[model samples]
Target: MDVPFGKPPVERADAARNREALLCTARAMIAELGTEKVTMDGLAERAGLGKGTVFRRFGTRAGIFRALLDAEEQRFQAAVLSGAPPLGPGADPVDRLIAYGRERTHFLLARQDIARAAVERKGPVPAGGPVFTQPHIGMLLKQARLGLPDPETLAFQLTSALEGPPLVFLSMDRSTAEQRAERCQGDLGALLADSWQTLIERLAGR
Candidate 1:
């Protein structure tokens, strides 16, 4: 019988052990040395494994970083799905959108280095895919029932504005990450003010 593609066969015990060890070591090295400085050879040496073993495990430095990043992204996505009000299910979609902007600003700031590495490797950044938060924002837009023909496009426009070049350039301006997150909330609120009442009415309809 063929298993479903999303369900992988179980890993062998020893293989699982090696994978865990490698990931643990890699995490430590990333914390100590930063993502770009954490080389494949260094990981293999520190893990006392052959370089080929590291390759078999993760394919490349980019691969390992992607794995680590996916794990982190999953947690953030979970919060948006079910964790709490504003960022989760219990609040109005517009409030949730604001909450999302704040949380994502902080998340991006914290993960900026890994994000930069992903960019360098032409890997997935945190803003483009359905697996990322953009689709969630699109869902919020739909929940608002704004009568827009392309809620996803509006979602893209909003996220791209908040998480785009201006934010990155602002990171160099000496504001703390927390300060930037506050600014994001303020900016988004101001930008969406004209449409805010419409969003509230839509949510109230539900």
Candidate 2:
């Protein structure tokens, strides 16, 4: 498949191979050393390529991290959306919502280091950003039939309640951590469920 560009098709094939090699090496480095240690020079050396090649493939270290975060987000999405009951289907909406938050808390705790590394060098975090789970939160709220004056705003608040506090308290002893997370999930879920029920009743009256 010869591209119309002045260079021969072999050049394009070589370029694609180099790009693949760089991305593969970068992924390996990130998995091994975490995101913080993944630099263009390091990736280049690991890939047996050059720094220029790395930059050409990913544009910046942030770009590489973005790709990594994309992979993480996909895994999270699949787990929450399709993996199993409670987090997925086969449960009542409120129960599922509570389970989702609890599971997300656990996921974040497990992947805290990679997550921290991914966000360390951020500017404006991208909309529907790979690192943030805002989409999942919104989807759950929508499925729960939570009609908010502003769905997006409510989703942010709910997700904050789930993610923000646990990340703060994750350093506690295991028992304490579990207790706090359970309390947060239960309290928040109860509050939101009540609000959602009220909203539905009010809408019905109309």
Candidate 3:
């Protein structure tokens, strides 16, 4: 689990408690009501906190989802770091790369709504991935021992291929990405993943 660039400024004990309470409430609300239905006012009311407090903690409605997404990313990265083979460790680098693409596709597409909503109307769009992506992919490409002229560049290109496009979809036409991504949870995920595996195989010449 990569931290977002650097350590956050420490929060007071009460602020920490409030952050935890609000995140739990927000998750429940989103699960029950969906992303569009979860709002700052509604969350404050449900969580029994002040609207100003929610605003200070999250900044904007989009910030709430961003906070949530950050927490989710930490958990996802934890699984990759220590959980099991293929996505975690103890598997061939190429196999891990292939598995990462498939699993990561599912993770992003499944959270399309929240990822999209996290975008600020005025702020630059956020990438739908953790910062660990590029370096992790680069390391794996090297370990795979492919005879490429520039595995480093290819690693970056591959990371973009795996992460960037799905994110582009996330910011598309209102909620089209959300709806389509929900549908993509089945066949589309497999198609993208299969394509990734094929690309890796060809690169590996196997």
Candidate 4:
């Protein structure tokens, strides 16, 4: 069989090395100086590559952050999918939801500066997509066989309640992160308990 020469060849080993170098430098810059201070020029200078090379590798500063955050999100997702109880698979679904909220709240607060950068650049969070939290909650609702009129819609509502921005914003009123997390957990407990009772009543009527 003959191959077409018009197609581009696979990336060369040196090009891959260059890409890895730029990513490594960019991550170090982000850790040392925060996302806002990590610029294309700085990355190029630090990696000993040309500015054009950096831009060609990532397109923009936002693209670099997007790549970094993508890796971080994958690790977080893996933890939720397979790591341990509560946030993983061993606990009740509702308890898992509570643990997820607590951990996600903490994660967002810890990386708030990076998160702010991602938000300003309109990057995606796993929970914000249908591929993650929304589906997880929706499936749990169905598994619980709750008599809610719209399980999917309710799932979105619950997932949104666990989002970082609103939680962080609400905690700004002289509340510590610890206080906010505890308050959120208590609120979730109350909301789920009330909803469960309502669901039971609705099912009894049928």
Highest TM-score against the true fold, candidate: 3
Per-residue C-alpha lDDT of model 1 across residues 1-206, encoded as one tens digit per residue: 86766344355667878887987888899899988688889999999999999999788777777666676788888888889898889897777876776677666556656655544344434444334656788888899766778888877776675567434543343346447648777653344443434544453453
Instruction: Score candidate 4 by TM-score against the native.
Output: 0.64
- Model 4's C-alpha root-mean-square deviation from the true structure amounts to 6.7
RMSD, one per candidate, in order: 6.6, 7.8, 5.8, 6.7
lDDT for model 1, please: 0.68
Rank all candidate structures by their lDDT, best first, as comma-separated numbers.
3, 1, 4, 2
Q: What is the TM-score of each candidate against the true structure?
A: 0.66, 0.55, 0.86, 0.64
Flag the better candidate by TM-score, 1 or 4: 1
Off by over 4 Å in 4: 1-20, 119-131, 145-149, 164-206
**Model 3: residues with Cα > 4 Å off, grouped in runs:** 1-11, 128-130, 178-186
lDDT-superior candidate, 2 or 3: 3
Worst 10 residues of 4 by lDDT: 120-129
Q: What TM value does model 2 have?
A: 0.55
- Count clashes in each candidate, considering only residues at least 3 apart in sequence or on different chains: 0, 0, 0, 0
C-alpha lDDT values of all predictions: 0.68, 0.62, 0.85, 0.65
Over the full model, what C-alpha lDDT does candidate 4 score relative to the true structure?
0.65
lDDT (Cα, tens digit) per residue for candidate 2, span 1-206: 85577576788899878866666777788679876687878888888876887787777777766666566667877877777877777776656666666666565565544444444343543434323556666665676675556766766776665666545543454567567758866654355445544543453343
Candidate 1 deviant stretches above 4 angstroms: 1-17, 120-131, 145-150, 166-206
Question: In lDDT terms, which candidate is top?
Answer: 3
